[model samples]
Target: MIRRFITRQLRQPLPPARPESDPYARALPKGDLSGGRPAVVRVDGATKQALETGRTRLLVAAVSFTLAFTLIGWRLVDLGLMADQHEPSLARSLSSDALETGRADIVDRNGIVLATTMPTASLYANTQHIRNPQRAAERLAEALPDLSPAHLRAKLASGRSFVWLQRNLTPRQQDRVNRLGIPGLYFQREQRRFYPHGALLPHVVGFTDVDNQGLAGIEQSFDDVLRASAKPLQLSIDLRVQHVLAQELAGAMTEFRAIGAAGVVMDARSGEVLAMVSLPTYDPEKPAAAPADARFNRASLGIYEMGSVFKLFTTAMALDEGIVDLNDGYDVRQPIRVARFTIRDYHPKNRWLSIPEILMYSSNIGTVHMAMDAGTPRQKEFLGRLGLLQPAGVELSEVGQPLVPSPWREINTMTISYGHGLAVSPLQLTSAVAAMINGGTEARATLLKQDPAGAGKGRRVVAAATSEKMRRLMRLVVVKGTGRKANTAGYVVGGKTGTADKPSGGGYARNSRIASFVGAFPMDDPRYVVFAMVDEPKPTKETFGYATGGWVAAPIAGRLIERIGPLLGVAPRGDDNELIEQMLVDIETNAEGRQLASN
Candidate 1:
């Protein structure tokens, strides 16, 4: 009809009819012959008017059609390109529904995903377009009974264009929800971060929000790195090693009836964190549902008076300052009388203890004398060199500040020597031990295992010779001293044991101690350093009314070593005394002092 109308509206006037009065006359009577020159009859005025109007109408119609077509093309381009960026939906940014699409998975050093991103479908609906909001909601609630219909109704009544039903549903649920076939409902592909290992490494592999924003742990620390790259992130953590640590620490925490537990396993040479476990840990997959207590990462964030563990640092200082020799003896029989404070051992051994024996027995008196010889200035400087008295050298943000006595008095130094007046985080202790055992090169503990060819550079905190001596002494402590319980059959583990009285209400809390053990495996050539701590452990029948580090933390470390050694490439050297001596000579030997020089 429109076409016909246009044709009629645009039709031109017909040529004036040939004169019809007479054939010859109408055709050309007044002018000469029709075929010859003089002749056509003139058109009437009405014909002329009709012809002019038709031309004007056709021109107007042509212009209008061209302009309308141009506008339609312009709008098409705008909708296709401009609207996508300028008027993006809230779902695009607020919900993980958009960003998680095709996100890379998170894997451990051994390609295990303590956390992973799985592709899943999210359910959403437009309230205004639903056929029957109440009925639809009922169907949805039935499909996912976890959702309440009242809540669904309120959400559907929110009058919003889009409301989220759920993000990242399981395939079975998605199929069920789809079976409902409710109008205005839709599914969006989303990536959900799933922790396959559950609570084992929650503190290491962090969780992500619905939109995949890292909320905690390594996930939060490296959120930007994960979002920007497609490749799987390889954390320095070994999942298998982490499991063993958790199992052993949990058993110890239960046996001793401790409030909490924490531990770490770091590669001494590269400072790579092979395994780190913080008890009371939560599952990363459901971080929101976890308790805050379970979420606290004690290994990296919690700081405690890690008792005689600091003795390692003091002895290192003494050796580095040339304040004491292996053969040099200090009289530990008399408790050092310094002002109001008195320094004594847990089980005092009254005798002239050599440098090795002082460490072997964890003698407070001998350690105080050793610290005094090195002096406050020298001791503080040496600890600072080892990254104590400050945050650890790692990428993690939850670092605990070391609690050093401000006055730096002689009494304070004495107490701090036995690991009492000072507090350091577990991470700090492990990193310091890594510096001591990894050939004296101080590398900050790393959660991402670096490619050996491209590993980071390190700062040498102590001389190679001093580091070797410290390692030997530490091994002696594990072999015959407080840390003897930590020795595993296959791994020539050497470590130190510590039991610190917890401070309470302006003074030390008697009978309350933080028991801990720090060890390194394959003593002849150190590989990994393991540190475990149980806070406020109570004496149990199994422990024989003792909660010492040797009884509590050492056994845990020993079990962890035995289980993780095979996985960590550490061979057993239970009878390799010759190899053990290569790192730690027998302190009782007459020529022990000459062994270092001979080697």
Candidate 2:
């Protein structure tokens, strides 16, 4: 009976087989099971919820990854292609060859290097990568003794992407740093402006800051030119002449016990400055450590009452204007009182003096008389023509403008005739004197190596004949009068000696004086103008207890001329006595002729 019942139930079309419940399956469509396919199973609520959550999470993760990659790609493009627009200064600093080709070298006329830029390793760091700040600082401090460990630790601990560890590291220092092998440490290429001669040309070649910006002298004046070109900037300076001038000036400064000294050697024909020196100079490598006074450029910047040097201009003016001849005489026996000012001679001859004698003796009284004859307007015009009334046209920026009397009074003219009342730099005085003796052409002093083809035939300042007479008169001074100490044996020297009291409290300080000598050698045809000045020189035993220009500066000029004559290719002659005798004869004849005319 049971078997018959079971068979009947089994055969009864099985109330449609029910599908089993599964955790991951869902219900199928109504017709999906008609072709003997497996029935779809139903899924539990927790399992379905988990699957949806996983799908949402996967979508979010994919979108996030795609956005991150896009942003990274855009940033790479910006840094690679458009970095200059976004970060110009950083882009410039990161260039591999920036410092190597930034500035040009500076050389003298003979191709001697004065100033140059050298490659150096500068230490920097990515502080974020530093594992231990204290350890890195201690290790770096050993390599760079000048750097403070405390400061280094502070910089390293700052968490900055870029931190300056040190600038301009020496090769030894760089090697020591590399040996440390610390993470985050880096080296960047940089440049340092170097002066091979150090203090030898501190004032002329000047110095630059850490970033290589020029601050003074030719460096300051030609900053743009130096940075724009790779070719060296050539100056008209002769290093050999510079060395000689510096040695002589330093010796004079020490011997005379002077507070300061200045010297200039210039080419009379081309107005090129071969040498310029100022004592109490400092090292260009360490400019900040030097005193302000040591950095002062006395040759071109410091203006002083140039004393008797002005007499050369006065004599030239009088002779050029036809206002006075070589025979013209002035009665300098007594002091002239003009408006409470007594103009007296430092070396009073107490007699009438001729024009040539006026310059030979450095006679302030005779020079005043000469200037009076020429008149104030003519004197100003004449000196202006000689370039004494304006700033010197040198390449340096330290040039001083001449201090002229604003009222233009008669006494002003008298004092100016003897190189008082008016103040000018040594450079200006040297240049003006060059004009007087250089065939009376206006000497526009320059610091550049002049091209012969482009060099201007300078404007005429005085007649050639007048300039010849002035040259003869200057020679007479070195041969017989105040400049006798400067009369070298073979080289014919011509110059004027000046000793002016320092101006103090609206009056002259009789004790303090500026002793100076401005001279030209081989006077037959002058080639160079040599000027030496000792500021506030004290009397020394060797100087016979006298600190006048003749005693203090004349010897320096003589020694300089003797040494540089051969170096400058100026052949020394046998004897200058014949030339001196001829000048004496001319002076005597002119005096006798003037006496006859008066009689």
Best by the TM-score measure: 2
What's the count of clashing pairs in each model shown? 3, 0
Error of 1 at 589 (Å): 7.7
Clashing pairs in 2: none
Q: Where does candidate 2 stray beyond 4 Å?
A: 1-101, 453-456, 586-599
**Relative to the unseen true structure, what is the C-alpha lDDT of residue 83 in candidate 1, on a scale of 0 to 100?**
78
What is the C-alpha lDDT profile of model 1 across 108-199, one tens digit per residue? 78887666677789999888888678888788899999899999988887777899998889999999988887878889876788888788
Q: What residue pairs clash in candidate 1, if any at all? A: 96-211, 236-447, 490-572
Question: How far off is residue 68 in model 1, in Å?
Answer: 38
For model 2, residues 222-262, the per-residue Cα lDDT tens digits are 99899887779999899999999999999988887789999
Q: How close is every model to the real structure, measured as TM-score?
A: 0.78, 0.81
Local lDDT at 33 for model 1 = 36
